[model samples]
Each structure stands twice: as C-alpha cells, then as structure tokens.
Target: MSSFDETQDFVVVGSGGGSMCAALVMRSAGKSVLILEKTDLIGGTTARSGGVMWIPNNPFMKAAGVPDSLEQASTYLDHVVGDHNDTPGASRARRRAYLIQGPRMLDFLIGKGLKFSRIAQWPDYYDEAPGSSVPGRTVVADLFDVNRLGDAKSLLRPNFLNLPAPLEDVMKLPHVKKSWAAKKALARMGVRALVAKVTGKKYVTAGAALQGQMFLAARTAGVDLRVNSAVSQLIVEDDAVTGVVTEKDGKPWRIGARLGVLVNAGGFALNQQMRDQYIPGSSTKHTSVIESDTGEMILEMTRAGAALAQMDATIGSPLSLPPGGEEWPIKPGAQNVAAAPHAILVDQSGVRYLNEGGSYTEFCQRMVERDKEVPALPSYVVFDSDAMASTMIAGTLPGARKPDPWYEQGYLKKADTIDALAGLLAIDPAVLRKTVDRFNGFVAANKDDDFKRGARAYDRWLGDPFHKPSETLGTIGKAPFYAIPVIPGDVGTMGGVVTDEQARVLREDGSPIARLYATGVSTASVMGRTSPGSGVNIGPSFVWGFVAANHALTVAG
Candidate 1:
C-alpha cells in the first residue's frame, strides 16, 4: 500500500465554481478539507465565464416576485431535454436532485456570507413551452472586490470581461447609443469605477466575482486551498476513491482523503484528439473555455472504473470570429446573428434557415447539422444599412467604424446592390434576392411564419427591445447589404464521468463507486445535451458539489 504524505477529511480537485462549495461543506461539518488546483491560479473556468447559475426557484427570483417552482422547472426540462438514453447523467433522478437542491445550495452559499442576485427577465430559451419561467431563473454573484483577498487576489483567475459594474447594469450599456437610460447606466458604471479606484478597491464581475466570494469564504473557514498542486491520479482502494497523487515540487505527493475525493475539473473541449474522437469536425480554436480543460481527471476517473456518457455532447454556441478576434478570449460572439431586428443568417446557397434568436447551443448545433447538407460552417450574418444604423453586430460597431482589416480579409463582405452582394458572396443573385424579399415580407406582416423568429420571449430579448410591433422582426431589403461569417463555437464541453443523484461516480454496471464524487464539466451534465437556460452548465456544477460534500460527510461519519 502507498504511504500517505498528508490527509484531510475531504479533498476537492479543481478550483471550479463547485470546488469551494464542497470544501465549505466539509468545513461547516467541522472537518478539515483541502482543495488542490492544477494551475497556478485559483478558480477554474468558472472565473473566466459569466458566473451565472441557472438554479430554478432560487431565493433571488422569489424575492423579485419571479415565479419559479421545482415542478415547473421539471416540466420545462421535459420539453427542452426529455429523458434520453445517451445522456445518462441527466437521468430523472439526477434532474430531480438538481432542481430540488439548487435552491438549497444557494441558501447554503448565502449563509456562508456570499451574496447573489438574478438577471431578472433573462427568460428561458423556450418560453413557448409549458411551465417555462418567462422571467428566467439565473442567479449571478454580486460584484466582489478582489482587493478584499489581499495577496490572494493575485492567485485568483481573471474574468474574461473587466467591467467594474454589476452584470445587470452591464447588460444595459450595449444600448447606450440609442437609449438615455442606457447612457445613464454607462455613466453610473464610470462613477463606480472611479469610486473603486479612489477607495483602493479592485472589483471583478461575472464569474470572477462568484469565484472570488467562494474563495474568500473558504479561506475564512480555514479550509486548506493550494494552487499548482496538480492531481495526476485518483488513488482508489478496493473500488473506492480514497485519495489523489498530485505533483508537488516536481514530485508525486500522495494526499489521502479520509472521506472522499471530489473532482470538479473541467472537460475536454480543448483536447483536439478527444474532439476528433467524440465530436468530429469540431475544432479547439473555436472554444471559449480555458486551455487547461484537457480531460486528464476524466481519464484518471475512468481508469478507476467510472463510466462515461454524453461524450458527443457539448454546450454549443454560435459565434462569428472576426478577422482579428483570435487575439482575445471572447471572440466575435454573434450567437444571435440573425437575432437583431434587421439581420438574418444565410447559408452558402443564400437560403435562410432556423430561427436564430432561440438557444445559442441549439443555433450552433443546427449549424453543425446543416453543414452536412449545405456549406454553413462559415454561414453569413446578413443585414442592411438600416441594421448598421440601428445596432452593433457580434458586439462590433457597424459601417465605417469597423476596421479596414474586416473588409480586406473578406471577413466582412459588402455590396451596394443585392446583385452585387450576391456577386461578392458568390451566391446566385436570384437566390439572395428571393431570400431577402421573403424575410422582408415576414417583417411587413409582423409575423415570421417560416421559422417564427420572434415567437419566444427569450428570442425577443435578443432583438432591439425598442423596436415596435416586434423586437426581432425587421426588413432586410435595404442595400448596401452587409455580411459576416459565423461559425459554431462553445464555452466548454458538458460531458465526462457519470455520477448518480447524490453526485457519486458510477461504474458502467450501474453501481456507485463508494466515496468518489464529481461535478462541474468534469461530470456528464445534469441537464444533458440541451441547454435549458443561460446557466444550465454552471447551476448543476455548484449544486452537485454541495451535495457531494454533504453525502461524503455522512459516509465519513
């Protein structure tokens, strides 16, 4: 038997959103806990993301009078992601577990001194479905001052966006050019930044805020948190995971977990070999997750007899990579390419397909599925001068404000007439013209009979809210028309080691591996393949992490 170098009542691998939740659970039970992070930084991809958790019936939603219930959430899930054989992680038992416990997790975090609020009116993707929450159920962490962490702040992972304002206020700033209220919000953000600077406080929003607060709580509770201590392998003892072999000072350091090991490490979205094997035609270059998500922990768990499911599944996001967008973490994210009131997407054949304003994951999945028949990998985001005048595309300013490289590199194509635009795009002039005319007809009737673009409340939120009669409906007939190439992208892959309702790693034979647990993207997603809402990927990650710690404590006792 291997000698144990050190031991804790509980051990958590990977500093993801749920990592601290589990550690905190152990701490609350008066047991010692240790968190081992592979990278030098604390907070995994959770810090780099938006940090919103799609927790149904969260306290914030109830406080705001937004109606949400476990039953209702289950009904919505039934419609968006019904029972499926392939995604065993999203079994009815686990799905029910997540919904019931999500609120409890939120309450637990709050009791631990973390603050959270919701994105009010961030509707469910399928509002047309029965029991859908029209006002949304996502809960976001309040802006946290990184300076509060002192020297530990430098060890925390950075968020993708540096906005000092709250997320809700930040969401409104995009409309600053058109709305006075938006401009006022922008001014407020400026004031907040100034206050933060003068007060010697450094504020971080989105994922960073959530992770920072969790880190702070864990530290206050005296839980051991270490970085650069990469867990190379899970130490199993007679079919039960009891510890881990992490590299310390360039040597293997075997740390024993007296209770269990919880692996919240991310998934394999960036592993090109795995991408090819599981989801072919997908590229790592297009993913939005941190490069550290290589799925090694998953392999370690598999070697320990854990079963895997939903390997072919990912949280797909439709993205438009501008010519120079490769320079940043967030590429040209035109998930709603045709979602603006005046724009639409077209394939190489100049035909408009699927509604663009629904779920971003679905949008990209449809893109990948459509690519089989028509060349749609580089589908074009088509809009006219009116669209340029009204709003930005893929968060970039329109018209002359765009960089010269956009046109020079052909990433952005333009033409003075529909015929000339067709010539530029190499599509038949008649097909382009006919597609535009048909879309214009839908706009005129204030109806989208073809794909029903504006049929859902969530879809309308993607469009110009100020637009009359319809938020997402507008004529695309005006020339000179513009187009930008969009590709399917994702925040991260959402599949790995399968876990049961209690968040225990399960073997292929349908039995739980004693004391072994997993959460975050390291486990097969609880929501399965379909992304039900904005934070479906994250909500389950936190809930199961909390559940794992409680269950492990019981077993340890």
Candidate 2:
C-alpha cells in the first residue's frame, strides 16, 4: 500500500470465473476491488467453457427434489479422488472445505442476484462410485442476453456455440434421429432460436452465460474491472506480496493491494514450452483453452515463493486433428462420439485397451498412460458403417455433408472391410479383426468384460440413448469400417502453484505465502488429477476464490 501509483483493497490478476467471484466478495465487504485481465477479453477460458459448476448439495438439487447431501458427496469424492500424498492441493482439509462451503458459495452468489440452476440429469462421471449423484449436482447459469452488457459485450470472450442451446436440449438433440424425445428437443431449440431472432436479442449460453451473469453482477456491484492489464511481476517485500507491476502508457505502473493480490490467471496449456516442461507429450495446438491461457502468473507465483504441484496431470480431452485443424483454437473432441454405439478406440497395433464409454478425463488419461507401454499417441477410433448412419463425428452429424477434403485428405479413413481399414492405419488386420470381433461378442452378451463400457449410468448417458437393449452396447459390424486418428488434448493443465484451505498460496516448507492467494487453474486443483464430474475445475475455482476473499476480509478486519 505504501509508495504505489494506484491501489485497491484487493487486486486480482486474471479475469477467469474465480476472479469475479473474489471481486464481488471484496465489494460486498465495502472494500475497493480491482480485476486486471491480461487479455483483451474480459473472461478467460471459463467464458468459453461449458461453465457448469459441480457443487454438491446445492439448492438447485434441493429444488428439483434430487436427494444429495454433503456427507454423500464427500464419500463420493473420497472414493474417486482418494487422499494422495502427491496431490497436496487436495488434502483432507481442503476437500472438506470445498464440500462444506460450495453450497454456501452458491447461496451467497444467489443472494447477490446471480441466477443459477442445476442440470437435473447430468450424472457424475464416476456414477458407479459409492455415494455418487446419479442426478448430478451440476449448476449452470441461465442463458443470458448479451445486449444486457451494453457496450461491454464487445469485450466479452466468444463461446464456441454461436447459438447456444440449453444443456438439457443439447443432450437430447444428439439422439434426434433415434429418439422421439430428441425430435421434440430439436423443435424446442428451433423455437428458442426463432424467438430470439424476432426479439433482436443476442443470447449466450454455457460458460458464456455463466460468466456474463457474473460480469454483469460484478459491474453492478461497482467493482473496478480492467481489460488488457497484465501484471508482469509480483512486487514482494520481506517475502510478502505487496503489489504488482503492470503497464500504463507503455511504462511500469505499480498497483498495490492492501488486503492481498490474488493470482487467478490461468494454466500453462497454451504455452508449448511450459507444457513440454511440465506435461510432456502435450501439444499447445491441441489444448481447448483460449489462446490467452499461457500460464504467466504461475511463473510469477513461483518467483514470489509459491510452491507448485501436480504439474504432470491434465484434464485429458481426446481430440482429433484434421488437415488444417491447427487453425481452430478449440478442436473437435472425439471422446463423446468415440464412446457412442458401434465405436471403439484401439491402439496402433489394433488392440482395444480400455472402456470406450466412460469419463472423458479417464479416457484421455488411459490414452496417455497407455502411450508409455505402446505407441498410442495418435490412437485409432474404429467404428462400423452403421455408426456413420447415426453418429456425430468431429462436429458433423448424421446425413450432414462434411467437407470433401476430410475424406480426400485421409482424415476420414474408410474401406469396405475391417482388414482394408486396418491397412489404412498401418495396423495389423488380424489384430483389429480380433479386437472388433471381441467387442461384438460383448455387445451380444450385453456385457463389456474388458472395460465395462455401458456398466454405469454415466456411461449410458453419454451414449446413443435410442439404441435398443443397451444404449452403449451396439455391434461394430455391417461392412465398410471406418477409423479416425485421435490424440490426447486438454481443457486445462491440472497443476499450478499450490494453495491451502484459505486459498492462500503455500511455500515448499508448507507455509502460506503472506498476502498471496490463488484459485482456478492457476492453483493446483482440489480434485487432484481426477475430474470427478463435469465442472470440477470451475467449481473448485469458485469455492476457493470465495474462500480467499472472505479470508482476506477477515484479515483486513
């Protein structure tokens, strides 16, 4: 606070989902809050993401009569994300804090007039785990009209879904050809689109909607938010973070924080150098994060004495790179479709390794781990011609015309026989035939003994719901086999500077760095390496951010 050009009670670096949450907290406490975003866009990856917050025992679940309790959620987490010495960020105390405070965080935000509702049917990724919520605890913001932001809408980050659809309808529409309910859902979406067109109101959904509401709420609360303001360094004094050095008029601008400086920047997913250094075999081109997510604050935190952890882990999203796919920031993830009926992933040697229908996070993790044993970096997703009649492939739905180049350039490898298809991928024809035949056997038995593909509700939920007998159990036969090469991509890197229950960054010796805090992907995740549900990353980021701001207020008091 001393000898600074400008100051605020709280200075948050990075305008991710957690940044606004913390700002609202400080403003609620009648303290001056400043949010500095490094990119021109106001929201970070959170705005472009699905924006679902997996907060168990939330009021949304209660309203829908979906039975869930803190104790049950805790048991589920304990089973899926067991306490590990390596993942210090997910310590027992931290896990308990998230469970006890997440519901409270939702209530607090609701009290401030930021609306939210849960996806009544989004199951936990590990649905078979003890105490898991079959009716998921996924909270999402309502579709927001961007016009409400006024001129500030221009500064908001763009979402992938140009015309965003409701989560419920999105899940249903994928099965439109096969399910009567899906056809109805499609009709509903068309109506919603028509109404918005007539009303001249531009709406954004998913992460965009979530962040839009948060951004509007923050502005209304009188929190000072700035874009294109990058904090280049943490100005530490006596091992305590006192201020930050950003830029003004192309010169150094010193901004001090009285209560604390929170580092919520982002992860190192988009920085290829950092990715290679931390998580090898990762490609910046493949990460789904916004290009601005380059992990600048992570290095700054380390310079300020913050200890980093979980550097080798990532929320693995299996994606395929077509010819010219590098042009797109968010490539088409193959995880969901690859897990659908009639499709199964295989190694270069044409051997099936793990369950095709399960947690996308686990799916990608298996690919990464399996790579160490065999050459599976660009694994083949083999499916039959029957799948093409129904499956959605790389953003292309059934009967939709794909770019001719997709087939001409070998992106869509197809042949009349399994042997021919395997030959296209340089895989052994007999090995692939055996693998497919074995899979078909499981389909006949309605059982996947190798990986338990359709054994869980979550797995079935992600499959083609209209498939008879079992949604995920369908034969890969019927001639003209096809395959696409898939590799491991990531939504965000799993590791960063480690923080404690208060969301205060800790040192290697296990002590909190004074006045230094972090949340979001900037800190080591609360679920450690495992993404137990849809919004584990975003949810923990918000909870810890809220916790940090409250802790700051107490300290200031």
Candidate 3:
C-alpha cells in the first residue's frame, strides 16, 4: 500500500526488535533495505514487552561511574551458565563474541541517536550467582517519541501488556501487603506524572524503540524501506542465499539481496506444534501475542541447511492459562495482582519448591522440574495482611502510573484462615496447614530451610527489604490470608536456526550458509542456560544486527 516495492537490494524478515535492528543497521550504511513483515503491522513481540535492553559494561554504565568489567561479567556468566563444555561451538562462540562486541554495539546505537537510560536500580538477576553485580548492568532505552517515525506508526504494534504507560509507572504496583498503600499513593502521584509523560510522550521497548530509533537513523542515511511485503521463501543460487521471494499487494516478486538475507523474524512461541514439542505442557497457556510468530522462517533456514542450536531450550516464566483451557489448577489473571512481598510458592502437593524470589525463567524452570517430578505445575503464592501492606515490592513500585489489570481482576483470593482457603483451592487441608506452619516458622527464624528463598542477593532483589527476620519470608499468621495461582510462562521462545558468531547462518557441518543471518528470538540465545540481567535479549539483538550488517556489507563489498 506504500510507495516502495519489488526491486530492492536487501530484504529483512519479521519486524521484531532483531529484524528492525538489522534493517536499520544496513539502512544506515547507505544500503537499500526492505523489511518483509508477515503480519500486516510490524512491531513483533518486543513491542509488547517491557522494552528494557540489557547491556553490561555499556558506555552508560561507565558514564554513570557504576563499576563493571568484562572479566567480572564473563565470570558472572560463567558462574550462572556453567561450563560450555558439551554445548554447540556456535553457541559458545557466539556468546563470547557477543560479550566482546556488545558494548561496541550499544555505543554504536547510542551514537546513531538511540537514547539509552541506565537501569541503575535493576540488579543482575543473580547478583549472588557467581560473577554477578549488584547493579549497573541492565540498561533501558529512553522513552522514544513515536511521532518522529512518520508513516512507520501504522506498521508498529501496540506496546505489549503494559500500554499507555512507561516503565517507571509499570514498575510500581501493589500486592496484598501494600495494595491499599500503593492504590492511595498512585492516586496521589501517578496522574500528574502520567499526564506530563503523555504530553511529552516518548515511546520505548522491544523492537519499536530499537527499530524506530534505528529506522530514523537509517532513513537519515537514505535507506529504502518497503512494508507490507511477506517473504514467501528464500532465493538460493549455487547453495548460497541470494535474496527473497516476497509478495507485495498479493503479487509474487523475486527480490535480489546481492549481499545477505537477515532472518530476524521472531521465534516460534506461537507455533502450537513447536510449543507442545519443545516446551512440555505449555502450549495451552502461552503468553506470547505475536500470532504471526510461526516457525516458518526457522523451517526455511533449516531447509536451507542451517544447524539448530539448543532447540530444546526456552525462556520460561509463570503465566495463567485462560479460564477455559485445561492443564493445571490456576487462578487466571494472577499477574494482575500486585506481586506479593510475603508470598511463598507451593507445588500442587502443597509443598514449597525452589526459591520463589527469583527471575521469571528460573522460577518457571523450577516449576517445570517440580511438575516433571510430580504431576502438576500450578503453584500458589501465599501472603498475609501485613505482607499485603505498604512494603515496596520488587516489580511494583508504589508510584507506578499504570495499574496492572491482573490486580483489578481479582486473580488474588483472600480468606480468613489457611484451612478455609485451602478448601476453596482444592489443596489438601492437612498438608496445606503444615506447610504454612513450617513456612511461618522459617519467617520467624529468618531462614527458609526448604528452598533458601531469600538467602541470596539475587533472591533479595525482588523481595521485601523491610520484612522481619527473613527479608524473603513473611509469616502468614495474620487472619485474612491470601493466595494466587501461578503458571509457567515466558517472554518468548529461545531456540531457532543456528548461526555463527558473525551472525551468519551455519550448516550442520559448521560451514557458513552464505548470505544468511539471524538474531534475537530468531536464533538460540547466546546466553545458554541462565538469564543474566535485564535486556539480555535486546542488547545482543543490537550487537548481532550490527555484526550481520558488517557481514552483509562485506559481501556487498
């Protein structure tokens, strides 16, 4: 429907953060670029995300005088991810390469006019996990002005779950302990700040901000952009990627890249078969809204001879299944509840699992493991009235402008006694009572013998600092107890077509698949097992896009 079409030098697929970064990078280099988005509107899952792009040892970190070093970062990664011994060489190699080049990529984008803000308070997910830092690792993009992109607005996706709100506001929310306090505080402070923010609105998050800023920079460099083109398949010549077969206005057209095909298309989170196969017992409850995110591109790459990396691995977190789906007992819309300060995660058998106060991925993985060992994945987060009081929770800051709808939805349940609530939840009464008694004892003693809930700095970051003997444990002795069901969820899947450290697609034999590249959720993550700090996905997306750009440029040269 737009002006540009058909003849173009480069065709990038999927408008997620990864694809946008690649498109923008190539565009800025004075290369003709066309983004072939499958969906009518572009912005992929990243648009609907928290929009924080984590880059460690970045210029922002240095400028802020926050202490960090590559040695420290690598050490921390090594500690959390463990040895790369039996991993794919490409995965290991890409991570090493990403770490080395991430700072440069971050600085390059900043230099190219992408504004970045330091998440100074956001600590590494595992600050106590081997080589972790207390802070100075996670960086977020400054709220970008969406109006600057002109016609690109139509192609952009709505900001995901947290919309019409900024990260500053989304961070503040209330749970049982601080629900009323947070409600009253937000009423007092959220309105003025929100009004000011919108009037001076700057959009940020996922690929939109990354791509928007990059797209603006690229346009300044005179890159040609064509939207509404869907890539049907790859054009291969003599065993190398030559271009793409795309449909414009419902007409087929062959476009020549003359350089490379960058597969920044997102992963297969929405692919039902893939989800069922890789992520067991999860297809029914996925949280990804990018319906166009099928594994077609990944399939295309595999057919083109690209080796897959860690295809079984995924980024997992707890998500509530919609009311109709059957998998496990869950309280739908629990995320709407203010994340609790004194909640303890319990398995279906009414037993505590891993430390509940951890990264979404870690928590989900623990739940998965627990379910695999037992029979169900649904877990309960239990808290008391005092815990539901005015304590500053991890994700919910008191002054958050945007209210989490989950809280307003009554995903949380309140009752006068533990046994009474257990009966409602179908939890075994005797087991539930004993678990609460033990957990309360741990709260009083400031120790969680069962799961070591708050024993580490990483766990403490998302926990209540003011809570008594145990910062992570809160006694549920107060009458009118509360419980919310949690399920395994995720930002997106992480397995995909294997690519070399240069961001070039590679074959099973490890030979580069010429003119083919991928990044973001399109490829397996560079970080293997453990998720480091925030923005881990976005930071590398920028870096690999830069890498892919240079590789494409080299081919063009």
Candidate 4:
C-alpha cells in the first residue's frame, strides 16, 4: 500500500477538455486544484480531435444569426437518440442538462479569455432530423499563438497539425471552385497568414488551439498540473472517494482530495484487451485516439464502486490500415477522403452496404452491421483513375504523379482493369464488376437507388460542388482502378462510469457515489449511440465538467 504524501482541495484525473475545464472552474471558485495526467503530455485525446463543440443555442450561434431553442434541440435528440431504455446511454435528464448548461459553459470559458468562433458552414450529422441545423450550432477555438503558452506549450499533447490555416479558411477551400464567397474567404486567410508571419507568432488550429487555450487558462488560474502521473487507484473512506493513488516515477504515491475526485481520464481506445472485450469485431489496430487512452480511470472508478454504461459503444469511423501492422495517422476532418467522388466502399462479397457519403460513424456502424452476415471486417474502398486525379482517395493526394508506396507495400492494390483489381483484393470478380457497372449507372442517372449515397446535404458537403447533378456522384469509368482496405476504427470508446445530470458518478443501484464525479469518455456519453454533430463529444464534456466543479464547490462550502 502506498502512503499518503499530500492532500489537495480537489483532484482531477486526466488533462483533457473535461478535466482541465473542471480544474479551472474549481480554481476560479477559490478552491485549490490538482490535475493529474497519466501520459507524459497533457490535453489527452481532446488535443487530437477536431475541436468543434456542438452546443445548441449557444451565444455564438445566436450572435451569428443562427436561431436555435432548447425545445427544438430536445426534439432533435429524441429523433436521433430515441428512447433511453432502447439506447441504454444518456438519460433524458442528462440530455436536458447538457442543452441548458452548454451555453453557460461557453460563456464561462469566454470570460476566462478563451477565444472561440462559430463554424458557419458545418452542419449537423443528421440534418434531416427535426432539430438539426444546416449552419450548425458548433463552435471552435480560434487559432492560438503558441507564444502565449510560454513554457507550458511543450507539455501539451501534439495534434495531427495538417492544416495550419484557420478552420474557416480550411472549410472554404472545398467550395472555392463553385462559390465566389469561398474564394474571398481564401483571400482573407492569405492576409491572416501574412499578418501572423509578420507578427512572428506560430499559430496552431483545431484541437491543438482549443486545448492550448484551456491549458493556459488552467495554468493562469493556479491549478497544480502534473504530467507523467498515472492514477492507479482511488482512496475511499466511508464509501466516498477521498483521494487517489498514482504511479509516479516507478513508485506509488497517494494524494488525498478534501473536496472530491473527478475522473475524466478518457477511454480505452489503446487497450487491446478492453477493445476485444467491449467493442468486439472492430479492428483494434486502427483507432485514431492517442496511445494514452487505456481506460485506467474506468478501472479505478469501477474499483471504487461506480457503475458502468454503454460499454459496447464507440465514436467509431472507417480508417485505412496499412499492411505489415503499420498505423496511419489521420488528421481531424480528413476521414471525408472516403466520401470523395468516384469512390465506393464494398464488403468482402463486393456489395455496397451503406451510403458512401454518410458520416464516418455511420459508415463504421454499417461495416459492423454487415459483419454479422458477411465477412465485412475489412471493407474495400474502390476508386478509379478519375477519382485519383480529381480528388484525394483515402488520404492519397490529388493528381499524384505515380502510385504511393502503399501500393508497393500491398496495403493498396492497383490494376489496369476492374476484374484484375478485384482478383488482387481476393474479392469476387463478377460481383465487383457488376457493382461498379451499377454504380456508374447511378452516377449517370444522378440518383442512387440502393443507399441514396449523394441524396443528403451532409453527403454533398463531402463531395465536389462543381460536379453536375450531385456533388457525391461521379462515374468510375476511368481505367486503372485502385482498392484499399478500410476497417472499423474509432476516435475513442464511448462508454465508462455512469454519471447523472450533475456529473456525479453513480452506482449500479442508481445511487450517486459521494464525492466522486466523472466526465468526457470516462463516463457514459451524453450523445447516446449516435453522433449528433461535429464536436458532440467535447461539448457535453465541457458542460458536465463545469457542472461537476460547481457541485463539488457547493459541497465543499
């Protein structure tokens, strides 16, 4: 047993959005806070994410002239999430709490000097739903200069860091060919870039910017942030979580919490055992989350008598896995490469199983759903020369001079003809040929009969607007076809310790565990089984973290 060395007024596990927000809120309320991060770097998986937070009726949305209401949001959630008993995830009360508190949390962060802007072009994942908006309710942090963070920037988790421009600029590039407004947006971005360069500031965008602002706020508020400290166990007294035992420097160190302990240490995306047990049949090797999300906090919370919910859920997506067990890191928003024109995803039997232009989560769910009947563990993304030339195919750059090394390494198969490519992929040649022929007919007719591929607004968003009739439809008639294997990969696991509307960890019998709180992927997701929109994961996380902090402060007072 490790002996107690010190005590804090409040202790927060994990250094992601939830934990950082909680720590900052508590510190602002005149409470001493300590944030323990399991990995050497802070920020957790939130730093690697898209950084968009889906908050309905937020002030930013209102300021942008996008109308939204709690009633409409509830109706939308009812359609997407359905019944709680059937979904077995976030309760209605919890959903209501998130909708109500989300704006307040955003305002709180703004007051703390964090800069955020509404993403005016991004739409809800299920835009056809009753409460869905075309110009979404999502907001993202502005590009932040690393110089503002000073020495603490080195301790933050690194993001994929693909597009250095602001998200508004990045989003406009796809529509530049069709919209004059998009071209103007790009020109504005160019000016911003020149200004940043002249100012001698290195700006980071997306998830990195969001986490950077939170980290700076936490440091400025006097939160005791510790990295390379893994919380292994919780200290309980009278059935209440009073402290935590962490593995630091190859030795166990115990630290007590006088107010409460909050577990926001992320999910088990990197733990093979947990992946096999919870999200079986999904490829464990293709997850996009950081390697540090091993569910240690889930185990610690469970050991402390917390109940679990939605263990079978994940924030899943389709990912290209290279051969020889090598992993491909995809930046946030890059998964749309699969939805580009002329590409079609097919199962082992060479059958199209889903809308090719659907959300990544929906695409992965289709892969899993089809796996029950056929061998769909590794689906093939097939595209032709036109697709390779016209747009990026599965993260491959557009107009590449030659085949990538992925082809030489057997991760990608290429051939001069459709039948030949199917043979190389070990798929039925006849089925694949017929499937492509039918898909070509759909493109020519400007309508998809089977899965309605390019029918939705979200589908068209991923496609080339310059294309005729539909943006997502283009004939795969060009020769020299290519195929790459895609698997069921995830951003993170969606299940963990159960928490109520107040963010208090709950027991199996529906009783709240005293002095224990949870948020982020460390608790059951408030979005239920479906992703409502971009940043749904981080939005409720921030709100619940705020709720937990305020509740703990009230208890302490």
- How should the candidates be ordered by TM-score, best one leading? 1, 2, 4, 3
Candidate 3 lDDT score at position 523: 85
Per-residue lDDT tens digits of candidate 3, residues 92-127?
Answer: 566678778888777767677677777657778787
- Window of ten residues with lowest summed lDDT in model 2: 162-171
TM-score result, candidate 1: 0.98
lDDT to native, each model = 0.88, 0.88, 0.67, 0.82
Clashing pairs in 1: none
TM-score of each: 0.98, 0.98, 0.86, 0.93
**Alpha-carbon shift of residue 514 in model 4 (angstroms):** 0.3
lDDT for residue 197 in candidate 1, whole number 0-100:
86
Instruction: Give, for candidate 1, the lowest lDDT window spanning 10 residues.
Output: 392-401
Give a tens-digit lDDT track for model 4, residues 1-557. 33478889999998887888888888888889999987889887888777889899999888878889999899888788877773334788888889999989999989888899988777787887798887888889999887788877788777776555777777666556567977887787778778878997778888888998999889989999999888888999888988998876688888999899988888887888887888776555667778777887898888889888888888877777554334555522334555778888888999888887756777778888898999887888888887777675454446645445676778778899999999998888999999999998988898999888777788887787677777788888787888777777778878888899889999988898999999898888988778888887888788899999989999877
lDDT tens per residue, model 2, 336-455: 667888899999989999887677788888998898999998898898876877887877787535678989999989889999998899998999999999999999999999999899
Candidate 4: clashing pairs of residues: none
Question: Can you rank all candidates by lDDT, best first?
Answer: 2, 1, 4, 3
Clashes of 4: 0
- Regions of model 4 farther than 4 Å from truth: 1-4, 86-88, 172-194, 247-251, 323-325, 329-335, 400-404
Q: Model 2 TM-score?
A: 0.98
